[model samples]
Target: MKQICVFILVLALTSCEYFNAKKTTPEAILNEELQTFNWNDVDVYPTFSECDSIETKNGKTTCFTEVLTTHILEKLQKDSIVVTQDVTDTINLKFQVSETGILSLLNIDTDSLIMKEIPNIEALIYSSLDSLPKVFPAIKRGQQVKTEFELPVIIQAN
Candidate 1:
């Protein structure tokens, strides 16, 4: 019918105009500038095991350790009810630091909450790690290297 034909034509024109009116702004264009450098691009320590080169003094720890732990705790607390509940039990996250200075969270000890909030645990780990500075040194062949460590974060309800 003629009415059906007209309806199809109007829809085609409307869709064309709708798509044409959409424009990317300058900020979006600038954000796409691939040359912009980020720490991830040039990060030396690529993983937790790669952090073996990072020397840990007996009393002197890296300045970033405390700050990074605090950030991770904050993120977990925000997203995890278990963390906020002040549970006396602890959950251990085992990970390896690659040579690239990136800590790969391999496994999480499943507490009641961790099993319940699987997505939150994954997001909290990634979000907290985004702000950490990468500066892992390389390990020597003869020297004993320690690239992996544990952080027992306490979950307390306030």
Candidate 2:
């Protein structure tokens, strides 16, 4: 009984150190070297909804779906990249936001009559990413979620 009590006491004391050693310090987590994304001026339309909420970690804000769509559309228009086709638009982009608030492309689909200028269309998406806002609420529970951003790039002559 005495030996059991001694062993338990020693285990308890050593366990603290073990846990501490395994834990990562806040500084280690916040250091620029450890960060994956660098936030810049990305134009994102932020929508506040039950599904959308702001996450303020490391002094940064992430926007959600509808707002992101609006922001992207605005970006495309600002660049004057008009779609020179009068057809059905079917383009979808699926990507993930890194911990540091950078977009990492997961999938892109460009299969539609509307996409005549494939290369330019792609460029528009990439260019707009800089101003793209982060998804809000930070995808609870799951490590990843599927979010789609669709656009119909149409060009009309004056």
Which regions of candidate 2 deviate over 4 angstroms? 1-63, 82-84, 134-158
**RMSD of each candidate relative to the true structure:** 18.9, 11.5
What's the C-alpha lDDT at position 32 in model 2?
53
Per-residue lDDT for 31 in model 2? 90
Q: How well does candidate 1 match the true structure in TM-score terms?
A: 0.46
Model 2 Cα lDDT, one tens digit per residue, 58-116 = 22333344455666667767765445554345467776664344555566677644355
Model 1 steric clash total: 23
lDDT of 1 at 64: 39
CA lDDT scores, all candidates in order: 0.55, 0.52
